[model samples]
Target: MSDMTAMELDEASGQAPRPLRERLSLGPFSDEWTAADWIVGSASVLLAIASAGFFGWSFVVSMKSPDYFQQAALANMPPKLDRIETGSIDVANAMPVPQIVRLSEPTPADYQIVMVFNNEALLATRNELMRVKVGSIVPGLGLVRTIDTEAGSPTVVAENATLHGAPATR
Candidate 1:
């Protein structure tokens, strides 16, 4: 306030800028480098650089990540089937399915289900099949006793789904 510019006052109080441009410094300390000082300075700089590197890598990955997530809203609905065929044969063998139609849904006795796999990347897993046999009419389809058993054959596999990872290269 006394006719001194802010910068001039800083200079008078020995707190001027024009530093941190080079060399390590601390309060009242300049060009002196000790073992502890070196360790502290090196570690701090290394940590800052490493943090920056990690943040940059994360940003790049986020940018390059698959655009599929934009369609995440679709996941909330019953998947729109690429192909849905109702039959006794498993059609998935002839095709590849990175995406699949779930044939495991219950059906009226008139029609059976078929699954087709057509995604090239996951084609190899097209034939890994699991079958579960359920006894029909557990209440009535069973044996001729007061308690019923396997009157007809249903499958336990209906309730289960499979997971397969397509191969990848580095």
Candidate 2:
């Protein structure tokens, strides 16, 4: 067995071990930075600081502005009034008179008018005697049945009808 160290083994393997400082160095070119590199780095840092300061100042100024938020909100919002008239003084001349178009003289309606009786409220009441069915007798008190010649047939179509027990006396 060869009595050689790790460094000797590395050397034997045609690879020289670098120093910790050199290995951890930032630049790949050289161990020491040039004057130009230092100047450029300092300038970059100074430029970054200056840019940050400018941005902060601008933000403070915008926040201090009275109509800043209002202007920003208005910029995002849709315009309320679309178009504005420039000159409008004469109301009589501007107003348009409606023209009635009469095609022919008004004729009597020929279509049969069907009457609809709504008994939804009476059906909703929870009284067995007061509740109306198909053939149930309805007391005529508040019930109103209107007969019109415009309505087609005089056929009685009764669903559930509301039955008032007593008449109101005032």
Candidate 3:
């Protein structure tokens, strides 16, 4: 074995020996804090105390004059009614009656249904049937169908198709 000095051994071990005093440093500002650091810290403490005192004062004021606070809170609230009369004759008289008559069955000319696969085909169909008034759209089982009175025959489109442009599945 080669005779290695203490410093050489420490260097080989990836560590440098330090004196006790150097290793016992308190913290970053242990030596002495700057005047600016002291001023900023004092200001921060004072601001926190002032904010707490202001909140305490507000709480005391609110507790002393609870009625004032309550009035302030209720100032923008809706007025309380003495009694609520549901389905009353006066309410019925005030309401406007609809003139529409109920129909037993909807007419075929009222709506139409169109089926498409992807969003692009749906947009194209919508553009083509712009004049036709659509009622509602039902989407399920990987199929989308439109309900409208003036819609043409349903069309089915799929992303993956077999030979001759026919869908692979039924």
The better-scoring model by lDDT among 2 and 3 is: 2
Best by lDDT: 2
lDDT of 3: 0.46
Mind giving the per-residue lDDT tens digits that candidate 3 earns over 128-155?
3422213223221122233221223333
lDDT of 1 by residue, 1-170 (tens): 68986557668889754544332355455466778988999999999999999989867866887554455646767844454453345566766648745555422231222322221111112333322123222111221112111223211222222222222223
What TM-score goes with each of the models? 0.25, 0.24, 0.25
Model 3, TM vs. native: 0.25
Badly placed stretches (over 4 Å) of model 1 are: 1-28, 66-136, 141-170
lDDT scores of the candidates, listed in order = 0.41, 0.47, 0.46
lDDT of 2 by residue, 1-170 (tens): 28986567667889887666665677776557787988998999999999999989878978789678678888999756533354435676666878644454221121121322342213222222233323533332223233222233232223322222222234
Query: If ranked by TM-score, best first, what sequence of candidates would result?
Result: 1, 3, 2
